[model samples]
Target: MISGLDDVIAAETMLSDVDGLNGRLVIAGHSLDDLAGRTSYEAMLALLLGEFLQADTAAITRNLAAARREVHAYVEGIDAAILALSPIEALRAMIARLPDGEDRDTAYRLLAAPAVFTPALLRMQQGLPVIAPSETLGHAADMLAMLLGTVPAEEQAKALDTYLVTVSDHGLNASTFAARVVASTRAGLTSAILAALSALKGPLHGGAPGPVLDMLDSVGTPERAEAVLAAELARGERLMGFGHRIYRVRDPRADALKAALQQLAKAGAVPAGRLALAEAVEGAALVLLRQKKPDRALETNVEFYTALLLEALGLPREAFTCVFAAGRVGGWIGHAREQIDHGRLIRPQSKYIGPLAA
Candidate 1:
């Protein structure tokens, strides 16, 4: 048996393809390069759900806006006690309160939960009242409005939309696999999504982006990048954004988000010097990684630019993964339904290496 199911084809999907060797990602019928900055998050969601659901971009935009308003009632119940947990934990706790189902309405509710809950949780923790979601605004725009209590600039909204689309799905990842396994058991979409969120909570999965920002904070400037990164590597600390388990070449999503970050910088949403420091750190990290581990392909991954993009868009680091869920929940729901339609009970075999009983 393969350890950790390395290179195992667990399931076939029409949703997204992750070509690790070439560092390419395709969602539904579109390449990541085509979809990221050009397509709206609502449109991406429509594409992902098109096979099983009939909603188009406009329909999705309207339904998702309504879903946000529906989920706000639950956000209103976040007490002082719930505010004590970390943002992801608080987000999880709130999501757990949503009912389970296998229908389209249920799917939309699951899709809207994180976007509605995350900003509210952040506000509550900061002793600020949670801003209600606007039904007229689009998904990314409304999420930004909720978080900031003001209308987001068009460029900022577009940047967040790009980020969401860039990460909407990858083929059979840890969390999406978790979602499918739970779905295989016929446990309903909410259970599947919660399982996925638990997997994403692990640092190896959805946790890296936050730490990339931390690394940037530590590096402080372009001149300090090499020294800081080299020191971290010398101490055997894995550089947060330098490598990915998949992708032998630089991740294409990294390029997608780097472009978005540059746009934000051009629009004056992010400082030019801050963007320069990030670029310097990325350049230095690549050089140091090559010099240190010549055998491995430790290239830039999505987390590097994801950190900068989200920070520039005004999301605190702690809420990064929550926002990730907002985008990925569409995929989770789509994959859950796909498994329900075409998959069976996912019971894999074990080698049973333990000693025999007497």
Candidate 2:
């Protein structure tokens, strides 16, 4: 059997394609560049859901707004112990409690859960009052408002909207695969999305952005970047933002987010020094990686700028993956529907090599 199912073409999907060799990501017949920052998050959702959504972008916007308000019910009256868990864990615990269904609304509701639940849990963890959701604002603006208790600046909201669109879908990555496997069981949308969240919690998948910030904090200055990266390389530690498993060249998502972060920096949203330090670290890490590895093309990937962008938007590092989930849930729902309509049981066979049983 192929280890980790490498090079396996398990599903035929029209949702998204990751052209790893070319370092391009296509979502619903459009390149990631074509969609990032250019399309609204609701527009990206409509594009991904396709016929399942009846070509109605307005319906999704309404459903997500309503669902964001609805999911607040999950945050109230919870155990104090559960409230004290990290934001991601608490958000996951709360989301899994959502009522399951296979209706179109079910997909819409689950898609809104991370956007709504993450900010509430974050405020609670930080000893701040949870701001209620706004039914009138668009998804990104409403989410930022709910978290920070005021409307977000247009640039801030636009940056987050770009991030959401850029990451909405990629090929059959691990969490998406987990989502489809659960979908193959004829499970409801809630169950399938919960399965995706479980996989996303792993450090290798959706957990690196937090550490990218950690590395930046540790490095602190642009002038020290090369030395710090050299020490990390000498110790054989994997650089957090320098490599990707799929993209042999630079991750296109990295460029998308970096562009957003640059825009935010130009608007004076992010501290100037940190952005400069991050850029320096990125250049130093790329040079050192090529020198050390020689064979593998380990270029900058998504988590590098993801940390800076989310940090600029005032999200805590602990809550990074939840924000990622907020973007990715739409993709998960699309894959689940595809699997349900067109996939088989998803059970793969394995061979035993440990001496034959008597």
Candidate 3:
């Protein structure tokens, strides 16, 4: 029996690798650290989709932006009555309306869906009208610009770019796995993305980062962090950002976001010493956690710094997961394409434990 299939090699891949034990990640031949502050989200997307998408960079960028514009129109047309729904629910509705297909145009559809869906979700949460996308700017810049109705600051743009690139792809996470399974059935690209988003909406997947802010609010200050954390631990609570299912050491993306947060803090874009305070809390909590658990390795993951960085960027907590979806749309599309190209119906058998009928 494979008994839990511990470390079972599922597929041969060229997408990305997650070395959990070593706390490293490589995407398409570049280490995450090398690419983090170095490449724009558009550049990183080109790298991930290059082997499969042969379109010219300018053409792809234009197509993607156009797609975003199209989806923005669709989102604006959604009834105001529906605006009262949860952000994720509203996003799901918008995505559900996307056209179905796998032709060259499908790439544009995938690109547009996230751009429209995420902003619409954010606006709905704020009880504001969703803004339509403008074709005049780059995709990442346009997203921030549309959401705020003004051109983003240079550092803000850079931070958003880093956030998007860092999260654009990860090898076969739960939502990506769901996407792959759907794509493996030769489903339409939109269907695959919808499935992926459904998975991502779940608490175990993309719903974590918002809670990190709550944790910070509860702790309130560096001096109070240890006492709050100690009490929370005593109550058998898990710290919001302290553990990941994959990385035993530390999430590579956390460091990247931490660096971005530090830069933003230095530029006086955020409160002074907030990052340092978070670090102190995290360090104290980790040390105390290790002493308590003794056997399990529960290190900080991407959500920790994700919350801090987005907070510094002045985004509300409710918008955190929507922001996540904005970046991950590319990876979802790429993986869906790869799964479709590979052509397998992802059917797996489960061990039967219930009694058989007579």
What would the TM-scores of all predictions be?
0.98, 0.98, 0.94
Candidate 3: tens digits of C-alpha lDDT, residues 3-98: 544576655567789999899999878899999878877777788786566765676787788778777778656776557767777777777887
lDDT of 1 by residue, 61-110 (tens): 88888988999999878887789988888888898899998988888888
**What TM-score number comes out for model 1?**
0.98
Q: Which pairs, if any, clash in model 2?
A: none
| Per-candidate local distance difference test | 0.91, 0.90, 0.81
Stretches off by above 4 angstroms in model 1 are none
| CA displacement after TM-score superposition, residue 93 of candidate 3 (Å) | 0.8
Residue pairs that clash (backbone atoms under 3 angstroms), model 1: none
lDDT: the better of candidates 1 and 2:
1
- Residue lDDT tens for model 2, 133-190: 8888889988899899899999999999998998898889999999999999988889
Weakest lDDT window of 10 consecutive positions for candidate 1? 46-55
| Candidate 3 to native Cα RMSD, angstroms | 1.8
